[model samples]
Target: MGRRAVFDDPALRLANNLLDVGRADLHRRIVAALHDSPLEESYVGDVQDQLAAVVTDQRVAERDRREASRLIGIGDDLLAAIGRSGTVLMVWRRSPQQVDHPGQNMPLARYESDGIYQGSWGDIETFESSPELRTLAEALNWAQRRAPHVIVRPWWNDDTHYWAGDGPPPDGMDALPDHHR
Candidate 1:
């Protein structure tokens, strides 16, 4: 009939680290100690770290309120899911590919597989066709039609040395074979 301990509170209402105890009595005693002890003062830096952790975790638990921390809304969980850590992602608002005046929306290409991405048939048929590049072009055209003014690059602003015949597509796209070559 007694209220749940702060650590066991299902809603995770407490901001402090949860207590660790192997036995119920030990757990109760620890909680009681915390309850009885004077409040501990922490440095601003330590509190900032704690606040960041709580805010990050809070953003993870809440959907709509999880933005403004990053421009792309590409939060920590999304990066960790992809094996990226300790780095920030910059998402551009506009694309430059539209400058080429290419007419079509990007047709979701595998980037490496010449496998067809038909939105209708799929990569398997596209591979069988051996006209994978053509299919990708068609997809790009399709995407252009949908988002005419859109640029198609990893990031929106910086002109990749790509089309200029200078260099590559930038990081993370190394998996994609050098189509230009």
Candidate 2:
């Protein structure tokens, strides 16, 4: 498949980007060429093996190992989503900041639909809901129950500042429509 096709497929692109591989090992020498190849079944298996090795190598950086392990989980989730017939609900969160003390394990809802929507908050960690939760409402409800201390917002918006919370949005802010609830 061409680069466009690879980019169009979220699962494939994510696998390639996490694996950080290219058409051949030679391309690895050039940082820019990394993740330029399509993700094949064999490549996915190899990448999983490589990530597993990273996770088990004591000499590797602790952060790298943790990241590898997280990527493995994401890869597994992506594969499962691809195999299933329904939509996959993913929750993501940004690290807490001074003004925004969202507490521990709080999810950050994006104002946009893109899966990798990182605004001023910086990099965010993604969490995939159980496959059984097929809709956004289910995901939001799950998040609300799982982290009641924190506020949750809709996965996407329609240019308006709509948000979802245990109660109606405070004062001036707007709550999500009835259907979204």
* Model 1 score (lDDT): 0.27
Q: Kindly give the stretch of ten consecutive residues in candidate 1 with the minimal lDDT sum.
A: 121-130
- Residue-level lDDT of model 1, residues 110-150, one tens digit each, is 33342332221112211111112333345444333222122
The lDDT per prediction is 0.27, 0.41
Over 1-181, each residue of candidate 2 has an lDDT whose tens digit, in order, gives 2212222233334334444533222123222322434333344445555566657767545765676676566556443323312222234323334445555544454433333221111011222233323455655554444332223333464245454545456676676677766
Q: Which ten residues in a row have the lowest lDDT in candidate 2?
A: 117-126
Off by over 4 Å in 2: 1-35, 79-181
Residue 46 Cα positional deviation in candidate 2, in Å, after optimal superposition: 1.4
Q: Each candidate: RMSD to true structure?
A: 19.8, 16.7
Give the winner by TM-score. 2
